[model samples]
Target chain A: ELKVEQNPLFLSMQEGKNYTIYCNYSTTSDRLYWYRQDPGKSLESLFVLLSNGAVKQEGRLMASLDTKARLSTLHITAAVHDLSATYFCAVEMGTASKLTFGTGTRLQVTL
Target chain B: DAGVTQSPTHLIKTRGQQVTLRCSPKSGHDTVSWYQQALGQGPQFIFQYYEEEERQRGNFPDRFSGHQFPNYSSELNVNALLLGDSALYLCASSLYGDYGYTFGSGTRLTVV
Candidate 1:
């Protein structure tokens, strides 16, 4: 079975601080996805990393994938209260259309 | 354009009852996938549908069944509901063989 694990399941940070969330998978996968979910809301796509060493950045968030290490990272820069949410990483194996998601990291940014 | 859309934002059902949930994929998407997300956990894949047929399924039991229409919309039906079945049912849409997908808000199903 493919297992995806995330580090720092819960994070409480002050505004302007920086943090990185890690996602490690047990098996090989073709793609990795980063998503953010607010309480009582559905997931919103953050980044899609398609290859080893692929990195994508949007505003205050950046994501990187290391397929050889079977790992991915979501780095938050200059965090703000609005950036507080539960972040998840998903792995897609081979040609399968389904995704296996990580346990998620709940981030709280206090002013 | 709208992303994926699911009906009955929330539902409440009792044990042994059956329930059906609906989904409409994003425009131009031909594949629909269903997932179950328990409280405080990530979503778990239940199945995927393409070309009006099941393309992939997860470790779920036969009680979990689904259908895809010609229009690419889909429905998920669960029989003999159990307390453990309570979770948020999410629907995702993508083009066939595509690497990315768009997800719906999900239906929050509560089992009593």
Candidate 2:
């Protein structure tokens, strides 16, 4: 069984601060994905890290994957209130694209 | 191009009843996957369908079943529902063998 764990289940940070959410999985998988979900909304794809040392960045967010360590990270740079949401990291084990998701990190950015 | 589409934004059901949720894959996408998300938790994979067949499933019980039409639309059926079944049901679509996915807004199901 593949188990995905994430830390800092809840976070309350002031605007302009920075933080990193960690996702650790128990299996070896090369495809890892990041998603963000707001209250009452579906997930929004953040990044798709397909290889070791893979890193992708969008405004205010950067995600990286280390396949050898079976770990992924979502870094928040200079947070804003609009950035508040629950972020999840998922591991895809096979070609089927079935995703085993982490517990999720809920971030709340305040002024 | 339209993204994934799911029907019945919300539903209410009693224990032991059955519910069916629908989904239409995104344009040019040939795979569909279903997920159940509890409040404040990450979404759990229910199953994935490709080429009109269920290609993979998660750890969900047999009470949860699904089907995909030739047009790439899908339906998720849950029998003998329980209060614990209440959650948001999300549908995601992707191209076969492609890692990129697009998710639907999800159907909120409340089991009483």
Candidate 3:
């Protein structure tokens, strides 16, 4: 069984600050993904990390994976209020398989 | 192109009743997967369908069932619903063997 864990389940940060969310899995999996969801809304895809040492960034958010360590990280640079939302990390053992999702990190960026 | 779409956005059902939800996959995708998301929690995989057959399933019980049409549309049926079953049901679609997915807004089922 693959268990995914995320740190800082709740976050409150000032705008323009930097932070990072960590995702660790209990099993081996090369494919990892990041998703963001607003209150009462569907999830929005953020990044797909396919291999070890893979890193992807969009705007102020950056995500990276380390298959060897079975860990992934989502980094936020200069956070803004619009970036506030619950973020999740999912890991898959195969290309075509179900994903095990993390507990989720709720972020609140205030002015 | 249009994204994945789910019908009956919100539903309220009594315990022990049965409920069905529907989903339409995105264009050019042939696989559909269903997930259950509770309040303040990440989505949990329920099952996946491909070639009109169930390809994978999670830890859900038999009371949870599904079907996929040739057109790749899907339906999720739950029997003997319990209040614990109440949650947002999300449908995700992707090409066969691909990792990228397009997710529907989801159907919020409330079991009273």
Clashing pairs in 3: none
Residues A1-111, candidate 3, lDDT per residue (tens digit)? 889999989999999999999999999986898999999899899999998999999999999998888889999999999999999999888877888899999999999
Q: Rank the candidates by DockQ, best first.
A: 3, 2, 1
lDDT of 1 by residue, B3-67 (tens): 99999899999999999999999999999999999999999999999999999999999999999
User: What are the per-residue Cα lDDT tens digits for candidate 3 across B1-92?
Assistant: 98999999999999999999999999999999999999988899999999999999999999999999999999999999999999999999
DockQ of each: 0.78, 0.80, 0.86
Docking quality tier of model 1: medium
Quick one: ranking by TM-score, best first? 3, 1, 2
lDDT of 1 at B10: 99
**TM-score of predicted chain B versus true chain B for each candidate:** 0.99, 0.98, 0.98
Could you give me the TM-score of model 1 versus the true structure?
A: 0.98
How high is the CA lDDT of each candidate model?
0.95, 0.93, 0.94
1 or 2, greater by lDDT: 1
The segments of candidate 2 whose C-alpha lies over 4 angstroms from its true place after superposition are none
